[model samples]
Target chain A: MTAQAVISASDLSLTFTTADGPVFALQDINLTVKDGDFVSLIGPSGCGKTTLLRVIADLERASAGTVSVNGMAPEQARKARAYGYVFQAPALYPWRTVEQNVGLPLEIMGTADAAARVKRNLDLVNLGGFEKKFPWQLSGGMQQRVSIARALAVEPKLLLMDEPFGALDEIVRDKLNQQLLELWAATKKTVVFVTHSIPEAVFLSTRIVVMSPRPGRIIDVIETNLPRDRTLDIRETGAFLKIAQRVREGLKAGHSYED
Target chain B: MPVTVVCLAILVAWYIAAVFMNTVVAEAKIEAAGGGLVNTLDISWSLERPVIPAPHQVVVEVWKTVFTVAPWKVKSLVFHVWVTLSSTLLGFALGTLLGIGLAVAIVHSKLLNKSLMPWIIASQTIPILAIAPMVIVVLGSVGLTGIFPKSIISMYLCFFPVTIGMVKGLTSPDPMQLDLMRTYNASGPQVLWKLRFPAAMPFLFTSLKIAIAIALTGAIVGELPTGAQAGIGSRMLAGSYYGQTIQIWAALVAASAVAASLVYGVGGIERVVNARMGVRA
Candidate 1:
């Protein structure tokens, strides 16, 4: 994988105005995600990992500091449709069938003949025949798969996922995570994933950025030295366990905020 | 299966009781003899009056009005029904357009919501019946008679529920879904057309059903004044003048059936649109 930075954040901060007072969701955050890198942001609840993802996606504005994707402002990058975002929940439009939902971004981008792209993405996610189904008709895992297909259908340069599998059970999440990695490897797109699960972070990411709460900030960024040819069997190997253990310690440390 | 059957059975029983009452009145008329004038205690009737007519009497009158008599004639129920239906349809179309436009505006702008919502709710506070005659007189003076006055009444009655339902539906997207749209850099119009508008379909159709019913009511109410040329409401007024109770009741039933058919038609269209859009149910 290339080492060129696809996303860069410089001293980012965000504060939301609430009824009680101004709440600082994030502070002085600086990070870089390299092209073709699978990076995971692991943090405690309310630690602003999702907020950071939103900022990068241009879904939310930063209170201070600057962020750029592909050497352009977030807004410009968004307008150019440079990235796809998967939310914590599937967030599929209930009224749309899976195929139509997957084709939505293409429709918005005014792309021609989106049917083939939609089918290809569905195949990538192994959701080929379920295109005619509604969101409510599908199980949680299947719904998330449809969402992933929707994000991939646009063929974005970067994929920003905010706890995309957070709502699923462990078994379903693990299967989706493996499928996601496979898809990512095939596509070779930059991915910035958010998760609270240590094992999930270790299993999916090339690097895990551990974060702390209460004025959310990244505590450490650990590079995983494991081979990139990850398979289900590799997950059971000693290297996976060692990486997972390291992520767990980092999470614990960040959670306690002792250092 | 359970409650529906029981409710239908109860309705049948009530209908039987009404038939029995009519029969009793008929029997009393028979006992009083066929004199030019007959009296049973304080109740009195002339020989010209037939016994309390059966349900068949009303049906026969309805058939005669619909088939033998043209609508332009004074006795024709068909003429009055056509008038009422035209006004109802016109008003329903106008109201639906206004309601949808208002809903879109409110959904798209906070300023529109803050400024217009309260006034919209307040407008429905005034009873349409009380305002109908004034609307007729004002519109008639300006030579804007025929369907306009009646349609205005229908518009007033039909717009409230539609506006409310559409507003709720437009804003019903889950937060994450909205964020997803934002992430894609979808502009305001794009979000509205692709997301908000499609999402609001079921609600719009439901409100339309209700609006059509109210529009029919408005049309009928509109005919009370001005001695309309023809309409179900005009038929009722003429029937009342001649004490033709059965005629009045028949016209009412016809109006109700029209309303039901209109609502059903809109529902059918909604189903077709949803199915084409791949929305199940």
Candidate 2:
């Protein structure tokens, strides 16, 4: 039970045929994310980090491998409502109120307790009073928080976040990072996050999967020795620096100029 | 208001054009009777049969027909306006439904996108006025007289704007939003009703405004071929036959007012709907 894998991928590959040529978006992507583990996928722009997250969410299909979520196919897991995904943008429906945006998935699932779920999730993200506001009425950071609330409203076991705070200012990003870590602790959900920031990857992840571009593949999987009860200040420590250094090296080694 | 000032300017311009165009008849008569240049300057502003009716004369005629005459009477402008408006409204409703249906099909099906869109544009190229008599005659032959032929013509004019506007609007959502819908495992109808349709509100209203005006035009055009007894178009035709330029101008003014009101009606509904949806102007 302790070693249960929430997501497991073996030899997963995806190739996109564009007008230019067949672009190898992912190649030999093998990874295992355990239950309650905070895993971060860090890479450069074309590294397919978001693509990999999309594949797990069943938004994209892998060309060459088998990937399972909660012991079921990604598509089946999607249908069973096994995971909640937070996209890079807030992606809130402009016409709907914050409350309705949060309740969208519940409404789609025909869940009986949509109101309660919306309230709880909004409260979880410290957005309790803003439920009546539209997406445009809220600021960028607030809007993103609403999106997070929407993803959490379903109370799924697995949470997949694709750079959820990448669009925010540094202060808002730091605040959201702390809130996200608290949320992870409270729910103990298996979290899969994608990021480009070194400190962000190092600060939040229990396991870091460092990836590289050209026909994207994992270069290193670094297991952190830091304590579970960590804070943003932990990044200043020598141990945190050591892991960050290794991740930076892994990123550098994976970078190729010719491609 | 600025709109009033613009209208006043147009009236003044129309009055000047009327005096100029009517002088031709006065000059022709004077030349035939042996006095030309001297009486050309003495040409009457209010002629019995002016090429373009004087603004005040047209306004007086409009006032007489709208207020003095009984509203239900055949001679009253109100009766004619009602006839045209009813047909326009019927056609507008049918056209909106047809446009939405076709737009949804086009957005969802690649087959319709490839096949139907070109034909829609091509349909517009075939002048409606040229085909109006045929449409009226054919429909009349089939025993479908009065408002039905007029409404079909209105539907033809109104549906294009709605289809194009809705196509742009239905596909307005970015890839990110579509992906979000996919993640929710939303069905096609749910996606349409919840996302695509709501996103299309602004575009839909814009097209509806254009559609209403065109629908009114269609109704008027439909009336021309049938020698309709009722409706603004028939009034203009009767005025033309009797050389009553003032009556024609009055009918034109009344028809424009009807179009303005219909457009305003749609605007009112749009405001209420957008407000309910939490959309700002």
Candidate 3:
């Protein structure tokens, strides 16, 4: 049987009204993510990559066209808790402990055995022992990890991430990327991720959607043939370099202006 | 350190002012009694009715009224303090609740925010002193005398700060945080209880401190119109009528002490809440 599409966006457009004029944040975007696919939307700043992710999460409205999650309206999917989203910032509640923060979604959903679910998710992110600490007390990277645990505790079929490690240092980001790849392999959940890093998209995504600004729209969709169970050392390999070169070329062809 | 030095400097200044202010009266009495200026300083500090009583004289009056007199007696400052504090606390509690209630409604309803906020801000421009008498008289006619009338006046004065502070606090959460709650598909009340209310703690405690202080002032002013016979305000009123400047000074000192203590008390609670919330001192 063919894998079912987890997310579908068709000719979607979003314009923000400003004092100067209407700003087209996203325009004529079409995309599809099949089950268990790790898809990354990569582009320069103002590319509306994050905006597109927000629309899929129903955090922002599309000015025109249609988008659906699990064949449900974005709003319906949101109310159904069909997906777990990790924002760029950790966005942890400062007043709550690590364990409580992880369990926030479950508490809201009023699910049974919440403590067990919280524990399982924390372990999944390798943050099992830091449950009692406050988010502020943890390092920035650790705080972000806790946020991932919080999202995973939702136990949704689809994960949406928006530059979840954009603010971290290179060393921490590399470590987190490796852990996230391992996490995706184990969970086998579909992911819709946004980022501006070429190497990050190449290393993490099964399909990379390259986009550009000035009424943000997709320019290329690169399907990678790299093995799923690969490590960071693959970035030094010729095949990995070829894919990364292609992504950089795609950005240049679209006048990405990243530099 | 600097605080102690400032306090000592203020006391010295107060004593010097007392001597200078009472010089005319003390000189007149000494000359009329055929006494010389040799004991004028002592006499000035111990005047029957000094324009400004000496610091020691005010302290002595407070000691005599508070410690020596039985607490429940009309002559005791403790009794007057209790009378004033009870109404101040009651009014503060009511005012805090009213302010929070209004703030919640205003934050949630755009219509209420646009319709109510301007009127609330305008209400403060009308002097509380002007409104207190009418409030007291109106309540008194309805058989709500004593503490209730005085408390209504205090509530009127204090609720303004609480409302403004709470409105700012309830809306204090960052846009991203609010968006996070929205992504959860959280209901309105759920968002308030889990996010907005917790975020507003620091602001609420700050407003409570200001509200409590204003409530004290309101209660004192309330005593004038309600003819409250037992409160510290009444003691000051009675002192003014008889020109007992020492008594008035003692009551003023007591009122200030109570205000400081109440603000300090609210700050203590704030510290505890902050610590529990994992905020570093």
- Candidates' chain A TM-scores: 0.94, 0.98, 0.98
Candidate 3 has what TM-score? 0.97
Fraction of native contacts under 8 Å reproduced by each candidate? 0.77, 0.77, 0.59
Calculate model 3's interface RMSD in Å.
0.9
Model 1 docking tier (incorrect/acceptable/medium/high): medium
Model 2, span A160-237: residue lDDT tens: 999999999999999899999999999899999999999998999999999998889999999996788889899899
lDDT of 3 by residue, A1-259 (tens): 5999999999999999999999999999999999999999998899899999999999998999999999998999999999999999999999999998998888888989999999999999898788899887899999999999888888999999999999999999999999999999999999988999989999999999999888899999999979999999999999899999999998888873455
Range of the 10 consecutive residues with the lowest summed lDDT in candidate 2 chain B? B36-45
Cα error, candidate 3, residue A7 (Å):
0.4
Candidate 1 residues lying further than 4 Å off, grouped into runs, are: A257-259, B1-31, B34-54, B70-74
Better model by DockQ: candidate 1 vs candidate 3: 3
lDDT string for model 2 (B53-75, tens) is 77778889999999999999998
Question: Which of candidates 1 and 3 is the stronger one according to TM-score?
Answer: 3
lDDT of 2 at B20: 72
Worst 10 residues of 1 chain A by lDDT: A250-259
Off by over 4 Å in 2: B27-43
DockQ of 1: 0.69
Error of 1 at A137 (Å): 4.2
Candidate 1 lDDT over A1-259, as tens digits, reads 4578889999999999999998889999999999989999998888899899989888889999999999999999998889988888888888788999999999988889799999999999999898888888899999999998999988997998988888899989989988998898899999999998888888888989989888899888989877777876777888888888877777687676454
Error of 2 at B207 (Å): 0.8
Per-candidate chain B TM: 0.85, 0.92, 0.97
